[model samples]
Target chain A: MVGIDEQDVVARPGGAASPRRVQRVPMGLMIPAAAGLAFLVLPLAGLLIRAPWTTLPRRLTEPGVLTALRLSLQTATTATGVCLVLGVPLAWLLARVEFPGRRLVRALVTVPLVLPPVVGGVALLLAFGRNGLIGRWLDSTFGFTLPFTTAGVVVAEAFVAMPFLVIAVEGALRGADIRYEEAAATLGSDRWTTFIRVTLPLVAPGIAAGALLCWARALGEFGATITFAGNFPGRTQTMPLAVYLALETDLQAAIVLSLILLIVSVAILALLRDRWLTAP
Target chain B: MIEGMRRPGPVVDAHIVVDRGTFRLDIRLRIESGEVVGLLGPNGAGKTTALRALAGLQPLTAGHVTLAGGDVDRPERRTWTPAERRPIGVVFQDYLLFPHLTAQDNVAFGPRRHGVDRRSARQLAADWLERVGLADRARLKPRQLSGGQAQRVALARALAVHPELLLLDEPLAALDARTRLDTRAALHRHLAEHPGASLLVTHDPLDALVLADRLVIVEAGHVVQEGDAATITAQPRTDYVARLVGLNLYRGTADGQTVRVGPDLALAVDDPLHGDAFVAFPPSAVALHSSRPHGSPRNTWPATITGLQRNGDNLRVQLAGPIGVAADVTPAAAANLELAPGQPVWVAVKATQTRAYPADVQPSAMTRDAR
Candidate 1:
């Protein structure tokens, strides 16, 4: 029976069923596919096998560990909120409006996605640091600075995570039927109200998926947060930053933090898979 | 000037002109209150563009649109009313009900936007749903509703706004044949009761005949003909309209009772009109013969059958000769005659069966004359 099941699985190429015959997979493809699966799974298995399981609970409860984890969660959530408020409208503008330089603007929006996180950190510092252009004016006028603060961690994370949210939401907006918007207009609803009532509800799933991805990206942010916010124990040091700092002094603690981050990320992705990843 | 000032025109009066790339649309229309005007046209004939321009969705490059004595769109004056501000409601071709909202919420959306309180908006939605006979299905999503039910909900949603002018774009085109009959009857009743002026755009002649008080036929972005259903069916001006009304049309020079349809073909019509004239007769009036027979009919011509198709219970044979014509024959008669494509046949019609009227130069006629 097991052999038959294995044969059945191997016979179905791309899950296509034939009326009278079953297709067989080529050995060349099967070997590489198995190797690819092992390539992805083996590193994760090693992490689990080498984890200091007995000291997990105690290490998790440590003041530094809890503080860093708490900061990471709070900042990631705050960054996601910021992305939602600003990114949704920007996505709408890029998707719906026609104007000069729109293509250039859209290309600029994706720059952060390709730019290295440490480079993004440097760019953010140049724009929002104490001695930077806007930062100097803000310091002189409002006596406030963003770099090396808890708020700076959120800023860096949002800078790195916003592109994912914008790209996803914009795709949803483009795919949505614009005729519904026209119908709403004919029903006496203005553009703004139509957007809020009709357009937003239609694209809610896309926004949710984008927000989840944005939050996940923000949670795993390390180089930008450390470079711009300067890793401080309770204020700016998030889980990834903490892992990096612990790698020098305590390998077990570093492994524990890494495990926690991996578990949270995987749980979120698993929870969202059924609703979003499999959507038509 | 005094007489013109005193004369009251239609509630909606407009001359709409739009330019898109190489295509230009110029159509003049007027609709009195409580009247339903159907804009019937073939595909890509600018019927939807005219509807969109009236709804303020498409901007006019030239001309103006006046609704209820107010200038809604006048490009010369730089005066334009946005679609939301215009007192018009449109039923899109696909019905376009919001997929995410329930039927009740979808209907209530307009009322809420116009500043009705939540309770009253829901109440208004309930009343409208009841009017459309869908109150029981108010909680269902759009996907849950049948096509006819969705169309009704769309109509109710548009009417809830209490617009001065209503536009329906191929309202019954999306329905199946069986559903269309029922939905058409329901729609005709609603249109009769509506107090506002309405413009319906459709390609189906039957829908226009049943639902419209007036029919305006457009072709190639121009208004080719406009009249009541009976007048349009009885006397079509263009070949497009003639084909739509199911008539074989011919343009020729008339002398006394005979109209020369072609160089060698002359049709004996009843009307004794002079100069350019049009002769029209139904395919059913045409009789096919295997050989020329001595008959009282004066309009007989030898023709070759080009095509044959089952039309209703009879076969409609397309004949091409000096004057192209369609002749309907019973299946037994067709079999007896052995009618098929490339078959030579003689066609005849009675003088009294053909109607003749003075012809006006039209775009289609001009092109045919050029050829």
Candidate 2:
């Protein structure tokens, strides 16, 4: 039997009793906690175990692999930038302003988060494809069509990823103390100036966290990009789409691609943990 | 234009009326330049509502606000000035200094917003910090400063804009007792030097007495009393103000030297008045006795001790009878009398110690003439 001293574990700074203390784990809770950890970690462990390690370096250098990886990175970053430009103000309006039907509008903004990605892709295509509602006007007036293009991939990714950014930024805006804005007004700062100077800086951390989440979601997007952009090798194929195509003919290549995505995302998320993840 | 000539009109004159739900606040205020008026009230007495209305943060439901002889808000005329455009500065109760900016930048924020160049704005901020005696701590953030230092920084930030009117809400309420004393003295000096009109809101009587030139006491949503500190202290009309100033107040009808305080209790006050009046004296003036003593004291009443507590070095006993009164006695005297709750005792006060004044004079009418 292993015995632990409660006093040693409960020792706090300044010798004061901490309101929240980590107690010795009971078997009732310990079993489920370990099982939950295993449930999340086992799949990543299996990916590493089944990876074709010997051929990974050569497979990673393949032109198709590099093109897909590069497209995924470029499209995800651009989509995140688009989300930041459009979602931040929406979040601000939702958080700060009072208007009729605001609750309904907020619910509509979050529709993509719960909607099937394939449906969202279909919705985007119906809106922006050639001969589609808005797409026909664009094609007739400016000779522009978004379907089967790189820009379509970015549009689809942003459509699916924007809800994350808006939700995070709006929560940040809500949590910020509004009295500082009042103070700014008393100091002769108008509404726009106050928003740019005081409101933006206060919610910067939330925006950063939201943008990271959005970029990660965009990178993983497959169904929407495939449905809306129509996979062509270099023009529209992203990593997830290439991984899907590779799975039909070459299982090893698919495993290698999946391993790459997993490794890169895990590394990036680990690096960002100290920054946005730990913030209150 | 002569140096000694008085200004023609007040810097701020306003009548503010705000209605919210079932509560309504109506107040009229006028302040000349270089005068600090303290709005003193209890928790839900509309002091903050009046302050916000003056700052243009809240609109008046009726009436108008004129600052420096210019109309700022007039609900009847459909004219209203937003808070940002008004030439006013406010130090909020918590001193909401921008947490992300350093003290210097926070102080410079107002001037920069008013179109001052960055270099000159920084210079102005430095000068204001120096004036507040926090020049050495200008580079520190608000969280790094102590409560007193944060208050001084807030003051500097408000004054850097060079506003024509200044408003403070419970400026010293956030500080510890020791820090409040020091900060209050410093604030008094700055207010004396300020050339603009200032309005301060506080519930503490000490803050009003020590920092303000005049006090407007609000109860519920209206002004119950407004006078200089000496006048208010000497005579408080409402029971609230009486308790605030620590006086035993009673309303009665006076006939010559005798005043009927209750149905059976008539206090012998040394005043010659005939109509309805009020009599007031300090608790220290009341003498407690175990039995009726033969003496030259003119007033005496049988009272039952209801409660007793330590008041400074003496014990204050609350007694209930025909007229409720408080008597302060030394602890030794209390022990000798064997005083306890529900003990019967006799209370007396000399006729010369009590003051009688006419009661029918309304405070609102008095405030207009006093101002």
Candidate 3:
């Protein structure tokens, strides 16, 4: 669509199939782009530079570090699972069904994406915590509370991360061809069968992308996880929280944790992007 | 599967009335088992709207649809069956063979949804693919299949359901000219084999003429003509139908052998018909003369050449006069006569070349009979 070959190679009189197309970046765009890249990469560079590489392996194997890292991975994965189950149906509703308050429902669905993570934690607490709305009934009925537990970490992470999955999946559903559904119906597929057999597979890439984003966001979550679930090392102290806690006593430990989180995210992103999202 | 002889009543019987903004489509249709009716119309004729209303994709504003002896949609009685519940299949214009599925799976989807087990469904799909002459391409996805191959897959998928009623919207319109010829022949075979009723919507006159058992021409949401291909082509009722069939036709009052088609214009026909009548003749019937020469031909008029284009091996000249008409001439004759636009020429037609019939049937009386 950009016609990169036409813009670059064809600009040269009759040079149609040049080995390399010289793409020019205007000074106005180039200067700001370079600055933006530097702004994002500088902190990661600093973390790597300050990392205690000599003791990195030993620190990574430490019980405290391993416990927090495991918790982070587990909570992030579980939260992504939760989002997939709940958010996908919500996305389908927003994309495929027409209702009186659909526009408002869609707007509300995206509220968590912009809401402060700390405020999100407070909202989750009031909704599901002790002596709160549904939490009171849950507490009285089951004697099971969510806050200050490992389960709370997943709940808090899911609450903060679900909007990403919902938005992406909804967009995918909206973009899918509705004519295929009609074809399926004519083939005698009920609405439920159509959704499971036709609609889901059609929007698989979007769901994958949304789940990835949700997982990544949940992995790095700090504000909501700590506020609602509390900073118990083995339960709620995820990588980001661990890094923040380590920063007070040892900068080297914090650098190592940050580097671990970065490596894991970048590796997963690179591998999945190539396998799923990259166009042939 | 639909039975050709055993069925007693029509496979589909419907009167669909749908209103979208100012456009209203009111059509009554009936199709006996094994009958393929081609719904032919110009753009914005509400052909697609009518198809959807019958398929239950869109709700009818009025009237009813009865398919396979069961009521499908009757707004007045509040009786309705959704598309999935109705025993119907639709081959969409683009085929819509699920891009993610193999050709086998695409065909199997219908059977599988209809409650056939997976392995048996796949077997049915293979048989269908073989019947459509795409057995070798069964493993390929829709994107990998050629246009013609995909068309077959769509047809197979629709038929795999064994629907009592089948709806095809512009089934062969997407293919290239060469592919269309073969595909049209194949589609004709398939439609014949399909014992259920079929209604195909198309703007291509050739597709309608060659594929349909009967042609139903609609214009501006109303039926303009309905008959067998030969009958419809021979006696096109409206100017749009006339143009589609490549005939020059006019309506006027008939006095004995001549019909006054326009002010100061009258054409002589072999048949003597009285009162309102229609006169029709092929473009090949008209002969052009550089000057007035009038012994053999009974009708002659001075006309100016408005346009000229190649129609097959002959040159089709559009003439403007009191009654506009098209005249086809050999390229040799066209060249020798110097047939260029704005050139004055004498047009002549033999009385025997034109046909005249009484114009007693009103436009509204012609229902594109497909129920």
Best by DockQ: 3
Residue lDDT tens for model 1, B113-182: 8789999999999999999899899999999999999999999998888877889999999999999999
Query: For residues A1-280, what per-residue lDDT tens digits would candidate 1 score against the true structure?
Result: 9999999888886464655575799999999999999999999998899999998899999999999999999999999999999999999999999999999999999999999999999998999999998988989999999999999999999999999999999999999989999999988888899899899999999999999999999999988998899998998999999999999999999999999999999998996798887886
The Cα error of candidate 2 at residue B212, in Å, is 1.0
The worst-scoring run of ten residues by lDDT in candidate 3 chain A lies at A10-19
Whichever of 2 and 3 has more TM-score, that candidate is: 3
Which pairs, if any, clash in model 3? Answer: B12-B371, B29-B370, B29-B371, B30-B370, B30-B371, B31-B371
Instruction: Judge the docking of candidate 2 as incorrect, acceptable, medium or high.
Output: medium
Report model 1's TM-score to 2 decimal places. 0.93
The worst-scoring run of ten residues by lDDT in candidate 1 chain B lies at B1-10
- The positional error of residue B16 in candidate 2, measured at the CA in angstroms, is 1.3
| Candidate 3 local lDDT, A1-280, one digit each (tens) | 5798768755776567665778888999999999999999998898788889999999999898999899999999999999999999999999999999999999998898899999998998999899779889989999999999999999999999999999999989998999899989888889999999899999898889889989999998988888899998887888899999999998888888889999998987896788666842
Instruction: Report the number of the highest-TM-score candidate.
Output: 3
Interface RMSD of 2: 0.7
Better of 1 and 2 by DockQ: 2
**Predicted candidate 2 versus true structure: per-residue lDDT over A1-280, tens digit per residue:** 1235665565554366765667788999999999999999999999899999999999999999999999999999999999999999999999999999999999999999999999999998899989799999999999999988999999999999999999999999999998899899989899999999999998899999899999999999998999999889999999999999999999999999999899889976985698878767
Which portions of model 2 miss their true places by more than 4 Å? A1-37, A267-273, B1-8, B363-371
Per-prediction DockQ: 0.74, 0.75, 0.78
Question: What is the alpha-carbon lDDT for the whole of candidate 3?
Answer: 0.91
